[model samples]
Target: MVRKLLFVATLSVASGFKVDQAPVKTALLQLRGGADATQIAKYVAYSTSAFMFIPAGRDVFSPGAEIMPDDDKLLGKMFTDKSKEGYMFMWNQWGVNWIMLSIMKILAVSSGSADFLKLGFATDVVTFAMMFKGWIPEFKPFVVMFGLELLALGKLAFA
Candidate 1:
């Protein structure tokens, strides 16, 4: 029974180590031209859209005590509507960011350099700042996103 318990513990530790190293391994592989360009592009698309949604959601749901005037334009109204505001705003923000990032990623892949990836990552950092500008005055989200962006930039740069 003691031997079995030790074996299980060792296996669990090894599994956790592998999980932590997965991203690094993938980054090394990508650097060696072993990664698929299409797949990388897809990841960039998904990640940027997902990141943009966070701010939009916060804006709609957590606008704080101050209320802005109702926007009169169609797109503005759709995004500012009380009931469906969060979803609409998220969708709208995601759409714009997604397109921009998609183009940048495509250009990066085409040029065979990771500069555009870094640029995209930087753009995200800025977006996060703008997103939380007046809402919370908190640095936690920005810091977290900054760390993630650094990791992403490192992966792309080495790729």
Candidate 2:
């Protein structure tokens, strides 16, 4: 998984970046690890260490939620939950991850890059397939945000 993601990361960079990779990687590494994108890309590509794995329980954020002050803040409150998947799921939806994902898809590309993008698109599909399993709240906003962003990138790659 890590190797595949590393390949994808290399390919994404090879593709092209309207914005660059160095600054982005620098910022994200500061937020998480130096290779946070590699981590996310690895997780998205394959299930790694079982104990280290984080189950992305579906519906942690469902539709039609009211805008009231959520007392529990339980929708995506994995940080304080002390549960198995809470923190993993929450961390996946953070700003740094979002930025990294955006950077991955926005890199330079050529005809030779088609296969890598296809692989990336497939990986994303598998990741989304895990959503809404009813095991955790469906982090709706993040679900839509991350989902649409990747979908859009996949579309760009195919186009």
Candidate 2 per-residue lDDT over residues 123-155, each given as its tens digit: 556656665553344455445544654554465
Reference-based TM-score, model 2: 0.34
Runs of candidate 2 with Cα error greater than 4 angstroms are: 1-76, 81-98, 108-112, 134-138
Across 1-159, the per-residue lDDT of candidate 1 in tens digits comes to: 999999999999998887443454477676867766545644654464456444544444553212232212223423444576476566555555555564665466446566776776677666666656744334455456555654555466555
- Per-residue lDDT for 111 in model 2? 28
Model 2 weakest 10-residue run by lDDT: 48-57
Task: Show pairs that collide, candidate 1.
Answer: none
Instruction: Give the CA lDDT, 0 to 100, for residue 135 in model 2.
Output: 30
